[model samples]
Structures are given as structure tokens and as C-alpha cells.
Target: MNRPTTLALTFLTLTLAACGRPASTPAVSTDDTSSGSVADAGGHGAGGNGAAGHGDHALAAPGPDRSRLPSRAVLGPATVAPGLRVQTLPANVQPNLLALKVLILSSGPSDYGIGTARALLDQSGIPYDVLDASRTPLDTAALIAPDGSGRYQGVILTDSALIMDAGNGTYPSALDSAEWDTLFEYERTFRVRQLALYGAPGSVPEDYGLRYVAGAETATTSLRLNAAGQAVFSDLKGAAIPVTYSYTYPSALQSVPGVSTQVLATDPSGRVLAATSTSADGRERLILTSAQNPYLTHSQLLGRGLAQWLTRGVHLGEHRRFLQVDIDDVFLEGDHLTSALTLTAPFRLSGSDLLNVRTQQDRLRSNYPAAPNFRYALMFNGGGANTAVPTLCTNSPWLTRDLLSSVARCLNTQFDWVNHTLDHQRMDVMPLSTATTQIQQNLSVGTKLGLNMSRASLVTGEHSGLGFMDPTDDGTRNDDGTAGPKQDLGLGRSNPNLLSAAVSSGVTYLASDHSVASQWDAQCPTCGVPHPLNPGVFLVPRWPNSVAYHVTTPDEATAFYNSLYGPGGLFPYWDRNLTYAEFLDRESDQALTHILNGTPFPHFMHQPNLRQYAGGKSLATDWVQAALVKYSTYSKLPLNTLRWDDLGAQVRRHTAEVKASAAGTLSGTWNRSAGTVRLTSSAGTVPVTLSGASSGTLYGTDRAARYDLSGSLDVPVTPR
Candidate 1:
């Protein structure tokens, strides 16, 4: 009685096959102890020379003007300690863009002449980072520190940003006389220099790092680095460009509906006081908003250009989030070695590798910026007719230890203990005791290794392959051996039975054993196939179309998803891929497109260490990044929430809105608008929207169907 249907779909302990189960399935260097040069960021040439024009006599040789002569060039003068030490820029840049390396003798919160230069760099999108002089103490003692990441394209000031006072033991906001002389010495070297006359003329010294704020008549008379890494006269003016606001509208998300947006000004008649608008892409936008927008609560305003604009000269488009994920599972000594689905995460085996566990953790961290969704699940084997636990199952314990600790260090990615099974025993052979033992050992090891095994959402154990199925975990081979409980894709009565088994044994997310696209079921499967690994998506079950490994192929993977998610079928069915890598990429790409398209992202989990998804760097890390990009784009939600329940709800909401009409129709509403179409009916109202439906309207009686639906639809008003 393999009755597989949408109604049978339920959450249970699931397992994915390795390839298809049982059945199938920083550069940096520098002894200088200073940050990299500004030229490294490329803006060197006012044109793009890529490097600072090499230092030459042209820069060192000052004009014949007697007054402009160096004020006695000195380095770490014994009489006066803590002075400036100048160094050549590490790299060169375009001549147009003035670049140099200025060294400060000490640390200061304010500029010795650095702030002005920083402002210019930020405005130009030139890369830069600040290094504490303390990190490279040697450079500081010598009045130079170029060992940091910033390459020498621009000004490098040593201990210049630091302003310290010895007499009062507290450096004031203003610089001391000695500091002025140091910047003055570099004034001649600056490709562009500024000169300011003091009230006392020659008596006054150079004061660098200070710039004209709101209202200033002339540059600081003492010394200062102008916008161009040059010393300028008090009357010298640097370029200042008003900031330009820019936003992106992706072509992918231009059609979803139901999103209503508007632009509003604070004072009604006020000129663009503030405004919120929506574009084809799903992103929501608000401009000129006050720092006090309550809706931007809980630090929402912290990013999204507000804080960045305040601190950095430019605003962020959208920041990407990164995370590392490792597969983990505790195991006992009785789990099977070659069973259809092996319980690896929480393996009840005799031999397991502890270091392998740490390596899994390392893999996750490597994809840090990519924000990989790391996870661990137990792999379980299903018994079709075998009896007695396998002897080889005992070795699993030693093999599982390594993965356990790897997952314990991080919580960003999911780490769910799955149910592999006890003694690697076949369900048909052993009694309920087998499932119990597997769960116990799996949970026990997780506890021992410090994993949060208390609760998780994926239950990948025995016969629990990747996809949902029925008869897969029914009563098993009965005493008669006539016909085991009905079986199909694990969605039959077997599923509920499996759930009861999971709850009784403490397991969820049942992995469908042998769930991959097999040669037998690869033909346009109702549940989608990675199991019984096959060739094409449309071949019949009886055909000889074999697996293309297809995942490695671009086209095959696409067909698999379309078949399952296509209209009028397979709604909200949980499915798994043949390998960890395949699952990672397919799931992430799917979720991201859905999000970018403004559609709801589907909830899916990958079993790390499952040979399939965690194979190579490109496959593992790339897929994880795809997932992170999708998650980050949402901007307000976490990755975990994209689970069964949330996805179920979204499926329904979007389907109705995408298929039905808008609201206020009977209320004599004129053109409601695009994306969000509103309609009015005697019963109630129905509003429809999707990720990219620019236009379309329809009304009808609601019908229960797959894919999340709120139930019922609205009647169309022929413009009554």
C-alpha cells in the first residue's frame, strides 16, 4: 500500500545517501611594521598609474626659497624624544593621485595630518585600515611602522595620529610644537603641499593633521596633511565632493506582487524630508529618514548606510554574512558500516575518528565570509529483510568522535543529531530496541563531546534517505514475510509510523534511505530523484537512463528542482540530494533566487561529512556562500527560520496572492496597483502578490492544494 501523497508528508528523521543511499546517492608582508601603502588600493594616479611615481630628486630637492628650507631634518633626536620618522611609500601610484608614507613618532586619537588624507581615501573608495602603533612597536621606536596590511600607495604617518603630552601627562586636542616641525619637514616631499601664514608669521610652527571643519578661514598655520597627502598653505583648499546616494535594483526580483509602498515627506510640503519606496526588486527602501525611525529598531539603523555613512564616507549597499558549518554525529558501537543509510553523525559504532571531527569544523571556518550553513546529522540504515545486527557496526564510535568536537565550537550553523541505528541492524531483523539503542548512543556521544544535542531539526537515520517516502519504515518484514508494510517514497503510512518511531526514540527529520535518483525511479519522479541515481529528469522508471552525476552538470540539477517545485504538483515536499555538495549548492541557489525574486525561500538542510556535500573546497564552500548570500539579502531574518513551518506558510500566502486578485474591489477601488492587487468579495477579501508578477488578476473559489495556501479565493467584480 505505497500510498505517497502530499497529505502524508510530515517531519521525521531523514538520512541522505553519499551519492544516493544504499541504493545510490591573504597576501601581506612587511618588516616595516606599518600598514600597506595607499597606492595598493590603485587610486594612485590622479589617472590610475597603479603605483606612486617612484621617489626621486624632484621630491627631496626643495625650491631655492630660503624660508622654505627644511627646519633642520632630524630623526629620533636624543635631545627631544618621540619625533617623526618619514618612510618611502611601499608602492607607487598614478602621478595624479598623490601618495606617500608619513610616519608619526607616537599614537594620537586625532590627526597629526592623517584625518584629512583618510577622508579623501574614503570618498574615493580607496581601501585602508588603521593599525595600532603598538602592534608593530619597532616601527614606533624608529618613528616608522609599515608592516601592516595597507600597502604604500599613500601617506604613512608614524605615531602621528597619536597626540601625547609629557608635561601635563595628557595630550591635548592640539599638537605640541615638536609635532609641527616633523610635518613641516615632509611638506616639501608631499606631491601636493599647503602653506598657511601664522599671525606671528615665522614664529608660528607647522601643525599637521587638522583640517577646516564647519567654518574655517585658512588651513591650520602649524601643519596639516591636505586631502591630497600633501602639506598645503593655510589658504590652500582641497577638493570636497558632496556625497551621492545610490541603490541597486536587481532584475531577478522585479515581479513579486502584494508589496505596497509609497514615498512621504515629513512636512507634507517639505522637499523630500523622507521617503520609502519599492522597486522591481524585493528590497524595501527609505531615504532621508531620521536617525529616530522607530521601525529601524533593535539596531536596524546601525547598518544600511546610516552608521556607515556617519563613520565611513560611503554607505553600504548590502553587507554579506559569513559562517562556518561542520557535520557532527555521536555514534555507538553497533551501527552498520554498509547499511543502506549509515548513522554517522551520532554513530553507535566501535571506531570513529576524532580529528576528522575537527577538520569538519575547519572546513566551516574556511567558508567564514561565505556564511556556510554547517550541520551534522546521524545516518541510519533501513532493514528490508535482514535479521540480526551487523558485527561491523561497532567501529562507528571511534570514527564519529572527530566530527563531534568540530561542531561544538560554533552555533551559527545547525547541528542536529540524526538517528543512524543500533548495531547497524536492519529494521526487519531487529525490533524497536534497535532504534532505541542507536538514538541513545548518538545522543550520548553528542553529550560527551559538548554538542548541544538537546534538540535539533534533522533526523537522518537508517533507511531514512533524503526524500520523503512511505512504506520505507512501516512495521518491516513481518513474521509471515509475505509483504513488508507498504513502501514508496517514505510518505506512505510508513512515514507516520516512522514519526512515532522517531518520537519514541527521540528523532526528527527522517532521512529517506536510498532516496537518490536511482535507475529504477528516475523518470519524472513525483518526489524528485537524487536517489536511485539516474540520467535525465523525464525518463521513465523502466528506462536505462543512468545518473549523469548530474549535480556536477548544470542542466540536470535545474531539471530536478523544476520538476518538484513546478506548478500543480509536489508542494512542500522535503527532499535531499545525493551528496553534501549537491545539497549545498542546489538548496542555496534555490533559496537565494526565491529571495531575490521576492518569493519565499525554501527550508532545506545538508548533512556535512556525508561524502556527498562536503567533498571538495569548490563544491562545499561555493554552495555555502550561495546560501549565505540568499540569507543576507533578506536583511531581517535568520537562517534557521527557513524551516518546514515557515516555508509551509510562505508557500500558501504567495500562491494565493500570486494566483488571486487584490483587495477593496467591491469597495469601488480604482486601479489598486501592480504587484499588490486588492479585491473585495461578499465573503471577505483576497490579495495576491508574487516575486515577479508585474500584472495579472483572477478570482475563484479557494481549493485545498499543495504548496502553502491560506484557503479560498475571492469573486471577480466586473467593474460593478
Candidate 2:
């Protein structure tokens, strides 16, 4: 029943020799008319018929449901041919060390469940090895090392039975009887847990106490966790997890002798979707009857729980949400629009505006418990600031220069500040002396203004000097804003003058635009790439939002947005124009994805967005509030708001860990009895993240400690 549709249909066409069932109808339908949509909002369609829409207009019909399902017929136990033998475990055989790694057993590369499992491990920085059962042989040697040490701490199966078509209308186990026995024996001997990503009820290799009730559930269904589920998935605080557009099998747990089964998740009908079965032999397994892919929201929500349960809350890697916003062009006047929707004079932040931003930040921290640490990072061009103004408490409608400068000086430590060059000059083609002066003069101005700024971080005007666009073009051209032809000559062609100037100016982390594909690190997704021309400098990328840098009010921003992404516009995406609220919904949805993915890249905007356009409302605050509200809906974990220097250090450590993993130099062993984890690396420093562990920086519920593992290091663990 767990085989593919074509194989299941073929099997149904033939009469079963064991059961005298008629072969007149197919076990599973191959019709692809299932309504489902993949959107950021709940990962399902907004309309009633599973169609997505913006504002009031309905989108086109959704495509077929891509989720795979099991056959309807009840399957029987696998037939072990003559001469096949089941191996017995040796008595009193104990292994010294089991490496802190997971092993994924899959039918082949095309298995959908593999991607879902890999996505969770990859984002969390956990190391794993995948073995294709259809191609590679699984034996005791693969599971055990020569020193009698177990190879993996956890075992994950892509499917419960590993059933696949064996030509001529026959579906059989890919592992065979002897291979299944070997895997089970190792699990029993080492006391390791196994997890099945997708399962169908009935005994092939073993029974999970699940009896099939229904299949092919394509509608969006809400699943509630029971007491056991709450213990397994302690991080998820939401009441219900929505499973959308998935081929889920609702089953009932049948009582079996010498086996205890606990229901984890159940649908509205009270049928089980996920459950754990502990056999009499001390082997435990968790099986989920729903199919999942990496893109599905249900998978993203449940993947971490599966990994944590399998590893007994001890694994190398950590996942924490972060939301850091960087307001660029601080202390500078930004161009804005008038009430008539026309370009007006540039505006600087008044005392009222700065106070409003502070009030909004305080409100956000108080309102959303998950984002209590939220704070903005100011990327300042100090040349526009008036340093002569004394720090004082001024009344409303004070002198424009005095109001802004005094308030900024008074609240100097409220926000994280970084140098954005002195006069906002583009450094792509600037001379070496000019670049050095721009970098040094800004530090001087920031110090004079009494702002606590970091000398190691730098954001050049327009992310210039990164060699993203044409190197020959002068700074006057605006290529990224307009749809003009530009060539990215790679980071190798980057301005050596700017790199040298940055190195000399004590800049270690130079900001780059994430929109430029070449600017980000290819090896590590959330890490900063080292500059090709200069090894001392690293390029940390920033995410740009849809909100225009100049627009202040919602109406002005909406007009500017529709002009670019509306119907028959320059870069049209939606069929019709969208209001400001709808635009925020779309933008916040994208932001939520990055936050959930654990990316530490700061989102960048400009100064005009801080202006108080309406009663207690500004474009920047509105955007942040919307994203925070969306985040509160799904998770209760605290969002980490790291400073620019801390973020760069984190990225550097992540890059080292990635390199160490690729080289296979990092190794860890968790001692269950002693409740400690020993980590060692043959090379440089690497980050070791352990759940329920002490002696590290506390992020959310987990702790991550960095170790220069040129030697073996042991850390105490609680083993949650």
C-alpha cells in the first residue's frame, strides 16, 4: 500500500494469491484533480476553492496535488524466500562510542521524504549520511565501526516498509528479510531510536500498532497534539498544526501484545496521524502516516521535533529565529512624496519622529512576548549630522537640527549604530585616499556625536565597492533601481582600493546586497563570504524589502509599489494593484520565511521610513509590527536580535563549522550515562550546539558554545 501510484495500480490489476480478493478495480486512483496552493499564508490557498488571491480578485485554479499516497488494499507480511536467515544479536556486546550523527535510509534519490528530512538537518547544521537502499547494501559493517563503536546515534527511514515495485505487478520490500533483521538487531543492541517519515499500516518488516482507516486526505486538516506529542515536540506551543495538501492516512492504533503505542497527533475525526510504538525488545519507533516535502508548512513545523526525538535531544546544530532591521541613511534627509503623490523636498527625522520610533519599539517589545528584544540597527552617514547641538531635553517643535541631534545624543545607546561612510558617497570607483577618508571621517563624527558605534562593521553607500555591477560605470548611474543592463564581474574584480581602505580602517564585516546573487556565500547559506581580493574583510549580505526607501506614508508607498509591480508595470508580478495592507501581508510573509529559516541577515531600509506619517504610524514600524504579529501566530520562541558585531562573529563561526563538516574533521560523542558530550575537531574552531546543555550562550531553549577543537573537549548535558 505504501508503493507508488503506478505500482499500486499495477498490483491491483492482478489477483492476490494469499487473499482471494477480486482484481476488478484499482486500489488507488491516479486522477490528479486535487485543489491545493502553496502560499506564504499558512502554506495554503486563501480562497475557498484552494485558489490564491490578492485583495478581492481571485487567482487562477490551482494545479494538481503533488503529494503521494498509499494504496487502499490491506497489505500482508513480507515473504522471506528459502535460505534467508535473521541474524541474532551477540549477548553482552557493548559499543564504546556512538557518533553524534544521523543515518537516513531511503528508497532512492527520488523519495520526497528525503528532502523534508534533509532540509531540517541542513538548516540546523546537523551532520547526516544518506544511504540509498535501492543502490547500496545495508549490513552490520555499515552500522558498526571496526572499533565496535556504533556509527549513528539515530536512524531515519524515508518510509516505514521501504516497499517498492519489483517489476511485473509485484511490490516488495527493498531491504529484504535479512537486511531488515540486520537493521533491527543493531537498533536493539545499541538502544537507538528509529523514525519513519511516512508510513502505511500493516506488517511488512514490522507493525507499528497502526490500522489504516482512510487515505488520500488532500484538504487542509488541523491536527492536535496529545500529551505524548507535547513531550516530544516541546518547542511547538501552538494548539493546532495545519496539514495542507498532503496525502495523509488517518489510522487507529490497534492493541498488540508486548507493544505499547502512544498517539502523538490526531485529526478532527480522532484518528491518529502520528504515533510512537515501543516494542517488547526495547526498540522504539515513531511513524507519521502523512506524506511530506520540504516546501510544505507541516513538514517545516514538525521536522525539528522528529530530529530532536530521534537524537534524544542531543545533536550538533541549533535553530533560533532572528529579526534585525537596519535603517540606512540615518541622520540624513531622504527624498519623500507630497500629499499630491509628487516628489517633494527631502526630509530628516524630527524629535517627534525619533520619539515615535522609540515608542513603537517599546510597544512591540511589550506587546509580543516572542520579540521582547527587538531593536533597530542604524546605519548612519555621520556627515549629515550636526555635532554642535548639545544633548538636552527639548520641547516639541524645537529647532530641526537641535531636535534631531540632541535627541539622538540623549538616546545614543538605544539602537545599534554602524558606519555607512562619511558623506554617503559611492565607493565603487572612488580613489584610495577618498575611500580611506570616508571610512575614517565617519568614525570621527560618530564619536563626536556621542554614539556608541562599532569600528569593525561598515556598510558602504548603496552597497558600493562590492563589484556587483559594471565596474566601469560612474557612481551617477542608478542601475539596480532601474531595469538597466549591468554586468557583475564577480568578487575577484572588486575594487582593491576599497578593500584595502576597509582593511586599513579596521573594517572586518563589510555589508553587501543580498539581491546580488554573487555577493552572498555559496557554501554557507547564512554565513558571510570572505573577500577574494582581501582576506581580512568578509562580506555580510543584507536583505532588502519591498518598501521604497523614500516613501513615508502608506498611500505614497503603495503608489510607488504598484507603479513597479502592478499590471503592465516595469516588473509586474501580481495581476492587479494592491493596497498597502495587502502589500504588507505579502512582504511580511517573505520575512517570516527568512526568520524561520534562521537567517541572521539584517533587513535594510532608509531614514524617511521612520517619519510619523499618521497618528502613531510610520512605514518602518508598520512593517515590523506586521511581521511580529505573523510570527506570534506560529511560535513562542524568543526572537534573537543580535548586534552587528555579534552577528558577524556568528557568521564567521558558522562558516568555520561548515568547512570543518565538509572536511569530516569534526566529531562528537554523547555519553548517555554520564550525560555529557565530547566534541573534537582536527582543524580550526567550530561551533557545538547541544539541546538541554549548559555552559553556552542561551538562545531560545538551546545552548550553543564555540570550541577551538584542536583538542578534545567535553561539555555537560542535561539530555532533555
Candidate 3:
């Protein structure tokens, strides 16, 4: 085939894969949650597997009303040489506008993802970054908010991005050389991160005929109150059936069309035990029943719910939302009062002694109950290898294992774990190989502890490892010989160090600090502290209310602070340098102390240190528990962890079964219909018709954008 023909055919297949739906399989079994609300998007009777495909190709001019045509057009036939890929993005979706960052979540290197995805993106010209998702649990603030890109829309997830076969067409979440290379071949890689649609909260009553809360998610776990209130859990994917007393958490994912909710199960203490979407069905309800009601002895209450509703796309008149900030990290290092309150020295140690240090450090919990609705976060403020000791984060293996084990049980109830890196290296400066190793180590540690997640979980920043990194990568090293960090974090600019690290390692969350919390009119523009890399920085008045970490000395503390009662300052709390005594005395003494000024004090500060306040057998457990309470109290919204693409699995499966009323491809019937463009082949006709310009850009929520030739294909579906 001529290069043009070949390119056209190739584009066709890629477009089909990109624009096609119902490609992914719903992993959750039928009625797995008891409501039996599963759909076959593009599959057979059962949910169909996610199969990538190329679609019809053929170029055309931009249609007058680009919004109406198929932004995603498929090529005619594979043999005819897959045609070129095409996309028609809404003008609202900017090439530089926010909406293309994807956080890939996976378990231990998923299969054949990066390579195939990268090849297509290269051929299709999409932008993205991949990170190892299986590093830490998906329940931390520091881990998920590393660069602050967590706010992006539409996070596309694939487990492990590995190419090795594990189940069905499924592969582990790991990657090899081919996948990495594919990524580089795609569109120019930029540091701009897009947000993922955290499960479009609440089903559209108009679209799905259901009324559900937005951004709600659910999972299941069992707690046995068998021994003196010590919580032991049954595997989430595994149901504990001891004899006839089978404990099944039949989760009812919302299947009905119009009725919706944010229902879930809670343990005895009102902690989120398992997340359930729908209500019970007749003889088909998911009942997490233990012998007698284990309510007191490790029993749970299956109906606690938070509400998160999306306010976008709706008419401005319908806009209404509560204050629910989804936080992932709030780290405190050394004596920086905040850090001292959050992080403790000798941080990454293990055993009883380490537990003691943590115990003493944990008094931070005493700060919890104070900030009820503050955005939440998972703490990774410290505990990586001691840089001077290099091997510290590595050597103190327990730093991860023992700690995570303790943390997981806690996480089963409170918040999600935002996985941070294994060794906290300044990603921008470190060698890619070393960065990979450090991240891999972190993933390995997560495995031992059983809190599986991808590099996407880590909320990271430019100042990892040997100090800060240069986001622009001018090749100048830091004063410490590391990649010279940036002095100016340009406006609306993000750090590439964290971006590259996240995508390469399959990380999901980016580290970022909210510059201010008040409206521009409320404070001085130049007063809020600048980001570490960007000096004399002024936060865009639009998004304020940010509290960033990465302080070891007192000086950094004062930069953001406004003495005691300044109107417009960086944080709502005292300087990180403040002593615990000062924190206590000054906080309540001076009604408007810096303590009460900036974004509210992270709930963690209110609680005691992970170990100090709460006594976990190990520091990790206490850390996890502290993180849980902090998040539970703060991330006040309901959460749905599945990626937007994952939801397509159901739609993809059902769509695959759909046979176009007309046999043959869109190209076969080209020229037959008034607007028809077709190509005839041996078996059937392939046609692509455009009422207008089918050539346009299809922009993803995350920065990745695709150009499709299909005038937006109009498919009408009657709501069930």
C-alpha cells in the first residue's frame, strides 16, 4: 500500500480504537454487588472485553458545526491500509487547555498497554504521561497531590501498563522497552497535566434515567471482631466463607436507569467499611451478613453516604455544589511546626523503637477533629530513604512493608491511599534509570504490604530526592549537582519533573501547592509565598486555598506566613518552624494567628502523630490510620475510583455486539448515499459519510488530543 493509503488505513483503526466505546470489560462479576446492575456495552451476553481497533479513514475539511459530526471517525478496512486518525474536539477544549492528563491505575505492570497506546498516540498525535501505578496505595494526600494536577479531568486507567498476559486479553500492569519507546514517538510531551473525570458523579437522570450522587465509589472488606476488637480483614476481592456462614459483600453497582444514590456500608464506628452503589434487590441483594450482627464484634453498618455532584456542562442556572476538596497529601517534615506536627525525624525506621518515635510524633492527630471539611490528603511527608544514607529508604525495608501493613487496615475504613514513590528522589534531576529504580522499589514495597496501586497514586512534585528539579530541564544541575531546579515556575506552568516521573512510572497524581485560599480582593497579590521553584510567584486568583509542603528550615516557613494575623498569606496555620508549644499557645491565643489564616490547617495537624496519638503495633499502621481519619474527615465528598475509560468497558462490551444496520464498513458504500463516502471490499461495503467536515481534533480531558475525520457520528439511544 502507498504510504498515504497505509497511513489512511492506520488512522482508521486508531480512530476506531480512540472513539469507539464498549471496548473494555467490566471486571466486576454480574450482580457482583447484588443489585445485578451490569451492562454489555459492546460485548456478548457477558460484559465484553476491551479490544482496541482502528476505524474508517479519509480526510475532509472542518464542518461548519464541528460539534455535531463524529469527532472520532474509523477507517474503512484493515486490509485497505487503515486510514488516518481524526478528532474533532470542542473549541472549549484547548490545545493548552486543561483536560488531557490521565492517571493510569494498574496492578504490577499491566500487559501490552504503553506500546500499543503509544504507537496509536504517535500515529494519532495525542499527548500523555504514564506512571507505575502499583507503588503505593491510592489513599494518601502527598502521594496523589504531588504536583497538584489531581484536579484534572478524565483519568484513563490501565492496570500496570505491562504487556505480559495475566487474564483474558488482560495483562499485568508492568511495562517493557517497546511501550516506553511508543510513548516518546507520540505528540510532543508537555508537563501540562489534565484531570480525570473521577467517575462522573451520579448517573445523569436524563441520560441513564437514574439520580445518583456524583463522584461516589464503593468497595468491600470484612472485619472480624473476633479478638478483643483487633480488626482483621477478609480480602476485598475474596469473600470469607467459613463453613455455611459465607460472608458475601454483594455490591450493587447502580444499574437501574434513573434512580440513583450514594449508599454504602460503614463499620461499627461509622468508618467507611465498603462502598455500595445501589440498594438491595429481591433475593438478589448484597448482604454483608456475619453470624448474628457482628455490629459490636467487628460488625458494620451498610448505609453511610456522602454526596459529590458535578456542576459542569449543566446550565449556569443549575450550578450548585458543596465545599468538598478531594485532598491526597499533607506532609510535614522535621521541626517545621507543620512538618514537625506531621513528619517525625528518624522517619523511615521500623520495629517497636520506630513505633515509639512515631507515637511521640503522632500527637498531630490531636489536631484532627478541628478541620471538619478541609480538603483531605495522605501523608508521605517523610519516611523515604534518608538521602544522606541513600539506602535508608531502601534499607529500612520495613519503612514500607511494616508501615503499609498497619496502614492498609486503617485505610480499609478512612481515606484512599495516594501512593508516593519508593525513594523520594528529585525526579526531574535524577537519572531516568535511577528514577525508575526508586519508583520500582516503592512499588515493590507496596506489594509486600499488600496496598497495590500504580505510580499514578503518588502525588509528587519537582523537589523530590536531592532537592528540587528543573521542570524545564535546561540541563543545568541543582546547586547539589542534581538537575538544576527552576527558579521560575511560569504562570499556568507545571513541573515536568513530576510529569515525566508520573507517566513513565504510571503515576496518576501530580504534586502541586495551592498558592492562596482567598479571593484576590481579600488579600495582597504578592504576599502569598511563591512555589519553591517559582519565585515571586502570584497564584492565579482563580484557584487558591493551597497548602504545600517541602520545608526543612525556618526560613521557608516565614516566606508564606503573615506574622500572626495578616489577611492575605500562604497558609492558614503557623510557620513550620513554630515549636509545638507555640503552635498550642499561639493558635487559640491570637484569634487570627497565621494558624487560623490560610487554607484551613490540614486535619492531620489536629490529630496526634500517626504512632504517637494512635498506637499501632508499628509506625506504618499508625501512619495509615492517621491518614485515614484525616481523609475521612476532610475529603467530604463521595468517591468513585474507576476511570472514565473504565466506565466505557460496559458501553464498549454492549457496542461490540451492535451490527450496523447496513452491512460492510462505512467506506464500502462511499458515494452511494448523498453524504456517503464508501470503499467496497470483498465481503462488504465500508462507508464514511460526513454531513460536514469530519476532520477535527478530539481533545481528551487530560492534555492528550486526537484529530479524527469522522464528523461526529450521531448515535441515538433511548434511555432504558
Best-fitting candidate, scored by lDDT: 2
lDDT of each candidate versus the true structure? 0.25, 0.69, 0.25
Clashes of 3: 242
Q: lDDT for model 1, on a 0 to 1 scale?
A: 0.25
Predicted structure with the largest TM-score when compared to the true one: 2
At residue 102, give the lDDT of candidate 3: 29
Tell me the tens digit of each residue's lDDT in model 2 across 273-303.
Answer: 8999997687999998876655455676677
Report the C-alpha lDDT of model 1 over 521-544, residue by residue, as the tens digit: 221111112222211111111110
Flag regions of model 1 displaced more than 4 Å: 1-430, 454-490, 495-497, 505-619, 626-720
**TM-score against native, each model:** 0.28, 0.82, 0.28
Per-residue alpha-carbon lDDT of candidate 3 for residues 1-720, written as tens digits (9 for 90 to 100): 000011122332343233211222212112212111111111111112111211001111001111111111110111111113322222232222222222343323321122222221211112233455345323322112333222122222221122223334343323233332222121112121111111112221111112222222223234322221111121111222121111222223345643332333333333322222322221101112111111111211111100001101100000011111222222222122242233233222233433343333244334443333222233332233222211121224454444433534233223333444543333444555655565556666554444324334443322242122235554343212222212323323443444444457664333332211111111121122223333322121112111112222233223322322123322122224454333222222221111111222121111112223234332223322333343333222222222212212222221211122112122111111133222222333222211112332211110111112232233211100
- Candidate 2's C-alpha runs over 4 A off are 1-93, 161-174, 200-202, 335-347, 392-397, 400-402, 471-483, 560-579, 684-687, 694-706
How much is the lDDT of residue 380 in candidate 1?
A: 24
Candidate with the larger TM-score of 1 and 2:
2
Please identify model 3 stretches exceeding 4 Å from their true place: 1-415, 454-457, 462-486, 489-501, 508-720
Alpha carbon lDDT at 533, candidate 3: 38
